[model samples]
Target chain A: MDKVENVRLVEMGQSNFIKPYRILFKQNKKDRIWDGIKVHDSVSVLIYNVTRKKIIVVKQFRPVVYVCNTTNNVQEGISIDTNKNPGTKGITYELCAGIIDKDKSDAEIVKDEILEECGYDVPIENIEKITKFKSSVGIAGCTQTLFYAEVTDDMKKTEGGGREEEGELIDVYEIPADECLKFAMDESYDKPVGMIFGLHWFHMYKLK
Target chain B: MDKVENVRLVEMGQSNFIKPYRILFKQNKKDRIWDGIKVHDSVSVLIYNVTRKKIIVVKQFRPVVYVCNTTNNVQEGISIDTNKNPGTKGITYELCAGIIDKDKSDAEIVKDEILEECGYDVPIENIEKITKFKSSVGIAGCTQTLFYAEVTDDMKKTEGGGREEEGELIDVYEIPADECLKFAMDESYDKPVGMIFGLHWFHMYKLK
Candidate 1:
């Protein structure tokens, strides 16, 4: 264990959109103090095609990756001219998910996320709450609930790539049930934990 | 899909200790500007006791819950006098984990987390990188690498519940291999996604 040291707390006002808090605490029997942040909880939905044995996912450009992957050659500060560089680090494959920042039941929020992100009209009753988990405990203490639902092709109401008004550029992709593990767990694939968890749950509890 | 409206970006300065960036993006082919934050990546480790057929986990208070659970009854603002309140909303059961903020390899960071968070002196070679995943997509685009390691009782060099010097109050708990799913997915249990992924992997590949 690292040697414990001084600890202090600095309070910052919350943002209208994002909530960022600076927390200071100690460790190793109160010998060291450490600082961290806490963010909002979220929801991840796994939509399965029962009739076809397939799972639906989405691919998008994450601004966080775009900012983190910035090179020294690229001058800091917002350079809207990123098209000149054509960066690809921001592209990611993830489960249909959203932050839990509304005044509705978890199931209701996930239902909306599914409709908005994946373009599926899944009835609220069809969605099953699998489990709730922290997105990351060490940094942000935000929790995420995992959900699963089986849908048929008939449930496809509109071309689902998220609402156009939010500036979301989503490409929906479906992989066969048997091939989900190989694709989701592929080391080269930019798969998130929620997607992997959703795949595992389908194979263990739904498929068999 | 909720109608996405005019979107815009408001660049915010980065912090020294914490990297909090304000990101604005569009959705659904619209020009609606939104605001969000970007955080650092992290790692989660699942330690298995091969001889005992049990999995190791840790419990701690979450600052997010401490802040979210506060209401009219609980006084707000940096009241460092929480010793009188003894709050309990942040307590959660999760896999041994840590943030990837250092200049070490993912394997090295996880190995260090195992030793510091769980008291297991595991060899780096014994740790297997299962996969990498995003902690949250809509909010924090931070990614986390999931690693699995099997340790024998002899590897426990010290009592691990997090370093006391950092003001960490952790309780170590172990669930039998056969009963992990029941406990981890028990809706009532405050289980995290990494633990569920670990148990499912153990059942799918290790056990059978």
Candidate 2:
């Protein structure tokens, strides 16, 4: 553990892609407040290919993971050579998800997400709510709802890899049902909690 | 589903507690990007009272949940009243958690959080990592790690209800292990995915 000091609000900025705000709040049993950020509410979907007995997954480069990887490298005294996209380590295996600030139902929003991100036209009725939760309770307090949807080959409409106009370069993958848990749990897998939770949900509730 | 138009970065602001950052991203089949916010990363812990056969939980007021309740009111054509904290409906039942940016090891930070927020002093060696994932992949992109720990009566150090100086008015609840699953699964339980996941993990891995 490192020495922790008090935190407080210092500054904030906004961009078309995202907004960055800072907070100063206390730390280390101190009376002062330290700084942190707060983002938006979002949703993540677990899409099961019931017909194929497989799981639909997505992989994409994430700027946050990239920067975090880069930061870790710098901390470990690794030499930084590539000035261009040095944080290329951001690619992540994640569930289909999107923010929830729109004026629409969670099912409707996830239905569109399924179509655009995975190229499946899952109906709103097919999507079941697994649970609604706050993603990161410690730093930012935003709500995220997890959804479950079972789809078959009949639901496939397009080669879903996300829209190019949105600057998204998503690669979609489908893992066999028997291998889904192992694949998601592999130590080498670069995955998020939502993805792993989704896989676990499939194993516990859907695998019967 | 209602019509969803493109979103643009509108405004950003900072308060003593949280910072609000907005983003404009594409949504629906439309070519329009939607507006949303981005917060920060966090952590949550599921503490098990091994001797007592119970799970530690926390309850507190959350402005975000409160606002969501209030916004639902507006959508339903309910007139807004009570200018002085009208969004009082922001209470949440959640696991014990905190931020990771404090320079402490995940075990150390969560260890302190468990003690501070829930009034338990479980040692670091007893804490186990369940999994790490992004809280809101669609928005904040910050990571949250879930941890599990088991303790006994000897671990009790204080009447855990969160520290007052930090402005945390937390109510600690310990549900018997026999009732943990149902309590966590109750539709009325205002819990996060991590908590439910923890409970599920407890059921699948720890209980038997």
Candidate 3:
């Protein structure tokens, strides 16, 4: 599913997603102006298909990760050649996640994300909260509430590939529990904290 | 140590930390441009004092977290009043961490952060590397390598309160292992995924 090409940086005005803000804080010794971005808090879920005995994961291309890997100079941008920085490098393994930009509750958004990204229609009653934490403490400081749930094959309604309209080319994967842990430990794979925490949580609480 | 006052947002031209960029990518179906930022990757360490039987945690004020709590508007910023949002609200419990800006190995940087932020003089041989993962996948996608180290009271080299010249007033706290887990679950405390993952890792591997 890696058909991405001609990745070039474009100078833009105020971003719809990341808004830079500098806040002045008077410290005890010296006054400091801290630079941070205002970003949306989000919800993520770690899913286990009980019938298949596999964990559900969504894989997608993250432009930010790609840019970070290819771009050496931060002040100025670079033209990312497909030969050098392939779309495969930008691909990241993540728990089914959605940013909190909608007006619905966090759990509702999680449900919507699962159905849209992974083709699973998980019942809201089956989801369990696994605690809330900020993934990026220094930059965004956005609270991401993590959840866990178990599903069956019957929960699958369609062949999900995320929302094509929003440029999401997600690939849904059903990996066995052990394989999932191995994948997380594999340094070759690009993964996020939610996935790491989810695997550890499942290992500690779910695995017998 | 919560004497922060007159927290107001200032409009700046370009950010020294976060530089926003829009990348145009040639997709399979429709051409889409993704917006992301160029940010710095960092290192964090979870420390356990073997002699004291306590887990060392650094607590400090995070401007981003504080601003997120105080501001309601995203486009136009709001003034953060101490009456409405206390400096304690901005405080986050983090592993001894530092952004990757110095010209050194990540492990060496971790050692410096431990000594500077938590005042622990850990032997380089004693420090062990945990798995690496991106905490903020959508936004920064910065890879943070987690490390684990065991120290003792005798290793306390100085009263670590972070770098005061940089306006960092960090407080180091050593909580019992069980209490650390309890604090992680407590919803009132602001924390990050590194702390959560580290706690679970300790609970699974270190705790007897």
Candidate 4:
């Protein structure tokens, strides 16, 4: 029960566009107890530009909000009235991020994500591993690798618009450092990680 | 398109612990769009016991490491692993949060979460909405509600434990404000949001 033991995958499935695998392991903790657990892995990125003093972000429709609002009978979740379907498309504002593809370095994956999501080519100066976090535990064992990047104002403009994907139609926007924090703290923004971390780094390096 | 509209949930189901639903909505943006999204309408509590100058955090296991770890052969968009069983049991660190039940108010939910997750009691002051964030976009549209709680040192004890429903194995740990940031940034801590915002708010309020 003292040495490293072997691990095995138990149940594996992909549903709702998420690939999740459960594992069973014999842990040599104290007396070689049999244990099993599930985990989900994903990736995220934070794009920062030094020149324009702005960060790249995107807005998209999120179906979950629509569901939450409707099921809870909450009038404020997301406006998804059948009569107003087109306009009330799920709106989610987020940072430039994507699942890590095989054969690509974290930098490469994030770089590609920057282009696909925000159309930016940022030199991955430093891959500051922010935190590997779990988005939800009750259902999916999904965890994400969060990283930060450095860019400039010219880089922001040159990157241009995002490449529209099959089911995704996104709009790229840039907000100043101060405003980024303001937006992140604002409830209307919906998603806040990218802006939260971007503003933190800005204050840590620039303001300080 | 300029006015707000209502939506209805046609069906709801649970997929691997996450609740998914189909919705029918009407809007003026384009046309009718049937959306299916995963809804995990949960609450995250950032507990700060001002009297103790400490915060509560929990650590558990995560399984997504295999996929996230590039060294593993989970590339080419291969969602399943047949060679090795990647088990999902690792010590993860995170904040005290629980899914919001249908009948509880936000304040009531947080109060209940505090006791169930960490075995503490505090008078509900006010629930400050941090932001509703989409943990991942590539998958279902699941969003999380983040909140903060102010408590006193008298509210906690040395051996705080989780509920029987939580498998009765969670070990609640109190972290001082100064060191919470470092722990939150560490990869070993399974959950990062509670620590992240906990430290952020501590520094922001302390400086003021």
Candidate 5:
């Protein structure tokens, strides 16, 4: 689903996600400033299909990845052409996740995300909390709570892709549990830290 | 060492870290845009002291964390008082990490960081490579290459507390291997995802 074209990047004018700030603090009488952005805290899930013994994952195009890979130092006055920098660089294998913008509990949000993104109806009681950690503390120190759940083949109901109305085009895929660590380490596939950590956690605690 | 004072947060001005941008693209002939920031790619080390059978970590005061914990919504023209919002929320136990600004190999840079931030002298050969991952994909997607190294008490050449010239004040400590997962899971200790993943990796592959 990465049929991306007509890519253009520019200096940010209006942003829906970034709220940049500078914190000035004095430690041991020395003044220091740290620059960061305020972002939404989110939740992610690592889903395992028990009948097939596979890790269900979602693949989609990420704009930040595309922009960073295509731009060199983000030099001003220079425009990027998609031909020179292919859009394939932006595609990544990610865990089913959603930003915490709803009033529902974190578990409910993730359960709903699983159904919307991967076409699975996971029971709310079956969802297990793994842990939550501060993500990317250097720039944006936001929290991301991770969860785990086991699903069977019967649980699948629809042809899994992200919500089309939201302009999302996600592809559903799976990886064998035994090969997850290897896949996580592979440089060919771009991935996030949460996915890698979840894969390792699964091999350590699950798939016995 | 979270003795912070005179904490004030304001709208970002000439940030040395954040460079915000907006990207516009067409996927399947549908127009879309994404907001993100360009930040420094970094390096982190998960150091395990073979002689002590413990994981070496660094605790420091993060300005971003402190400001986020204190400020409500980053409202403009409003000043923050540190007394009302304690600075302790800014303190975190993290892996020995440094921004990849220096013109050296990632391994050499991480080795130097171990000495400056954690007071250890790990050789280049002992520094093993872990998988690199994209961090905080939604906002500032930057590459963070992780490494692992084992050291002995002899490597403790100095009292590790970061470089004073750079205005860094870090405390060095260790955690027992058997209890590391529990410590990483503890909500009382503010930490980064890289540190948690590193701890899990150490238990899965490093510890005998």
Candidate 6:
């Protein structure tokens, strides 16, 4: 089997929150038909509060899931809501996550996010890695790092203050462990990595 | 506490697989201002092979993860590659996955993908869900459904014909079970959901 090679980035450009990069490639097999391809790397996180018997989840807006859900509804014989306008379905729920900033350790960025997004101060020792995974492939390129920590109920209430940026209204919730698992299984939870790690932990530690 | 009002999708549109949807808002105490928001939703899958002790994974040209990795290298004093161009990174490994086609159960869609992408005919009963989680928020609106299945080693030989329309080039491999967890943990693995499920199953059934 031929080994898959990694192409290096040659050019890059970024705006406020969006960044684009170029990659170098070479043809491998005689199939020269498959010469080279470019790809993207992304960062994501998962936070679990074991002591509180809950997980820190955020409810916000999501545009893609909304479209898929709407399209599914239309195909399933469910009536579409005609009064609503475009981009309204972007709200979403997910674990505290952000792209990995350049030059920052995964732990450092995740630690900061815990405070900014969930208002909790998580010690590095307590932030155990659940796993690293990919988020999507169609267009956006991101890989997520899922982590867990045991936050007490007291911590949930005292450090519950969250970030409020322009057009970003985040609501932090201390979801019950069982309910969190149910939500993860049902795909009702907002983010994909959150549900993956939540259910993973449940399967590993909770489910007998 | 005021009840969290149910959000409704108002309008939606899709262009070249990049979809953006609009949502309607029911006002509550949380906010007295905005009447609606825009959102997006997407789907992903985690394909596992229990019989072969390997899991299906994909390595693609990810413009995002690649860029992020390059940025990290620049910060670390590593020289950037100057020979590459900007394009989608196409890597190979994994079972079958795609954005949910409108109007189908995620499971049903994934089951079909297993046949289309992996060339396996496993019963749906074997398709165990690991979790549903989100990928990113600051940029894209999407969620993923991670899943696992037990497949025979011979199943690995099955050809996963690529989806040309979608530009998906798929290949099937039956990696060793013990190495799967380690492979999944590597930075290159990127997608952790399938690994998470693979590791969870390993700990529960194999390693335990």
Q: Using DockQ as the measure, which candidate wins?
A: 5
The per-candidate count of clashes, in order, stands at: 36, 25, 0, 35, 0, 75
Interface RMSD of each: 16.0, 14.6, 1.9, 19.9, 1.6, 19.8
For the second chain, the TM-scores of the candidates in order are 0.77, 0.77, 0.93, 0.66, 0.92, 0.62
Model 1 vs. true fold: TM:
0.78
User: For model 1, what TM-score does chain A reach?
Assistant: 0.78
lDDT of 3 by residue, B65-168 (tens): 87776665744356767886778888888888888998999889988999998998888887899888875777777788898989889999999999887777
Q: Model 4's lDDT to the true fold?
A: 0.53
Q: Is candidate 2 or candidate 6 better by TM-score?
A: 2
True contacts kept of each: 0.30, 0.13, 0.78, 0.18, 0.76, 0.25
lDDT per residue for candidate 5 within A30-80, as digits (tens), equals 787788888777899999999999999999888888777676666444566
Give the Å shift of residue A193 in candidate 1: 0.6
Q: Worst ten-residue run, lDDT, model 2 chain B?
A: B1-10
- Tell me the deviation in Å of residue A60 in model 2: 1.6
Better of 3 and 5 by TM-score: 3
Order the candidates by lDDT, highest first.
5, 3, 1, 2, 4, 6
* CA lDDT for candidate 5: 0.84
In terms of TM-score, the best-performing candidate is 3
Model 2 TM-score, all chains together:
0.74
The DockQ for candidate 1, computed on C-alphas, is 0.22
Name the runs in model 3 displaced over 4 angstroms: A75-77, B75-77
User: Which candidate gets the maximum lDDT versus the true structure?
Assistant: 5
TM-score of chain A of each: 0.78, 0.79, 0.92, 0.68, 0.92, 0.65
Q: Please, what is the whole-model Cα lDDT of each candidate in the order they appear? A: 0.66, 0.64, 0.81, 0.53, 0.84, 0.48
Ranking by TM-score: 3, 5, 1, 2, 4, 6
